[model samples]
Target: MKAKKSLVALAVLGTLSGASYAQSSVTLYGIVDAGLLYTSNVKTAEGGKALLQLASGNLNGSRWGLLGSEDLGGGLKAIFRLENGFNVNNGTLGQGNRLFGRQAYVGLASNTYGTFTMGRQYNALQDYVATLQLVSALTQFSTHPYDNDDLNNTYRTDNTVKYATPKLAGFQAEALYGFSNSTNFANNRAYSLGANYSNGSFNLGAGYARSQSPGAIGGAIVGNPSSATPSNPLLDAARVDQWGVAGTYVLGSLTLGLLYSGSLYTNSTFTLAAPRGTIHFQNYEGSVRYQVSPTLMLVLGETYTTVHQSGESGHYLQTSAGADYYLSKRTDLYLNAFYQKASSNLQANIDGAGGAASGSSQAVVVAGIRHKF
Candidate 1:
């Protein structure tokens, strides 16, 4: 039986190689997820609206791509991947009309030294936020007070290089650096490090990242309005720094996860403006999940965030619950709800940034289906 299986595998490889026989073994795989969504008091910059919404893959953004690896011999392999994300409803590039935009990179993989690559990429914090959450890492739901930076961001850094280590006793680490690719004032660089370990029901992870004079929105706290208008401490840093630690434990049919994060800044400068004050933010998240059945789950989670805008500081709280059922290994259906309240100097929900509150809060409930192919 083993010999027969080997022969079958060889035949498939042979058929695939007919397209490019002498070079390498290459394969392609990807996922596409989509769903219809609704928001209660949808906050838009113009105003708030309540209506039926058809959101594309809020849980797992619909994506497709190609991955290939060529044997370079000498225990080294040339590897490349071009993944593109798209909006299912309108059939448009999901991330800013970028061809092979989601992840476009080429690098080398080695058995002994690990692997290194370069291109548009995510920082350490962006990758680990999912493992630390049990709501299946819902982008529109589980993010609560703040979504995972990477999932929500369409474009981060342009040029970059990354290295990931081979696993060590169920432990692995990665490091990344990004360059802005500019002529004058081109010292812009961002760096990050991440590490994780998993053993049985217990899993843990930690990560740190620093952005040197990055773009303001993704950069340090540039706050609202540019730096020139009086000094709003929130806009004090051109350099942004972030660090996080998160863990999960599975006990019987229940799983518990917790995460903590902090952000710091150095000099917040703006384009065509002077300088503002500094800003720092601290966030904490906790969640619990119970397996009600083989294909059903019950979850409850909360997030607390405190934003320190120079001397003045404010805080907010968010609570959420959601569930997912696997109709099959590659398809899922889900429903979720969120209730959020704020007591802060800043006014913003997950959707819009500025609003006048009755010290009022908002809520959302959504049901969606996701299929991966």
Candidate 2:
């Protein structure tokens, strides 16, 4: 009888140990960055002037996140991530003051299949095309004029359901839909699709997104409209359509990239002080990164944008250069600069770093350090 009881007890303990091993796994991760910045041509109702101040997120945004996974047997797992973006200077939330503004998602993953998630999340365009832009390589300061096409991740979609396919033969695809969740059903709907192909050192991607009345309450787009220098003006439009394509090639320690995107805002409320009208913008950019040594890197890029209104047109030209010295795998120091010139009635602006420019040109310089944990 004692021998039989011992066998049963051993089996129970083995099962409990297996369950614990499969269900208990969590991680904490974060990045912190701080810097000093100089800006020329900050425009206000009063006037424009050059200014210098301490800044955060010069090379990368400051953020902290928690992620966890549970193995559910049968090659499937449950996963979740909660990420928060914050300003290092004042210790405030970054995305419209939301605690987990950067990302908050719960999903399931399968080794043979792909992953599916739901919650506030990034659209397909940002995941596929915008991430390949050279402007992103140079940092937020080099973002395309106004970041009109969402390349700089100005906002995220709420009430979203997203699916990403497993990479097969160097190809992967993603789709997302955000619900308006209103009585009208489609009052503020948003959706996007994107695909990418990679082989060896070359990658190409494209994506498209559309939204209607996005500025409505609890909508897909999120930003502070009252701010003098809003990041993206089309967020308040009656309708918005955007698409982009990007490619990058790597050779040894050198990399080159090219990107193009266009955005159309129909019946937009904000058009550089215009009351209402249709506005369109096209942006093209090229960028290169070279490793000077195992610890040092260099980057350069340029972007040109063309804008069209009912009876007016404008243009923007921007140049960026930057360098980074790696102190370790998780820490780095950097210097970066950007100069932009606007034509016609378009005002120069670098969101978060500088205000709208009263004149036709704006320039900014930044130096910073970043650490990851």
- Which number leads on lDDT? 2
CA RMSD per model (angstroms): 6.2, 5.4
TM-score of each: 0.80, 0.92
Q: After superposition, how far is residue 140 of candidate 1 from its true place, in Å?
A: 2.8
- What do the candidate models score in CA lDDT, each in turn? 0.66, 0.85
Q: Where does model 2 exceed 4 Å of error?
A: 1-23, 223-231, 273-275
Instruction: For candidate 1, write residues 6-48 as lDDT tens digits.
Output: 9999998887876564357656665666555555555566566
Candidate 2: 10-residue stretch with minimal lDDT: 222-231
Each prediction's total of clashing residue pairs, residues at least 3 apart in sequence or on different chains, is 7, 0
Worst ten-residue run, lDDT, model 1? 227-236
Candidate 2, RMSD to the unseen true structure: 5.4
| Model 1 misplaced stretches (Cα beyond 4 Å) | 1-13, 16-25, 43-48, 134-136, 144-155, 184-186, 216-237, 265-276, 351-359
Model 2: pairs clashing at backbone N, Cα or C within 3 Å = none
Quote model 1's TM-score: 0.80
State model 2's lDDT: 0.85
lDDT of prediction 1: 0.66
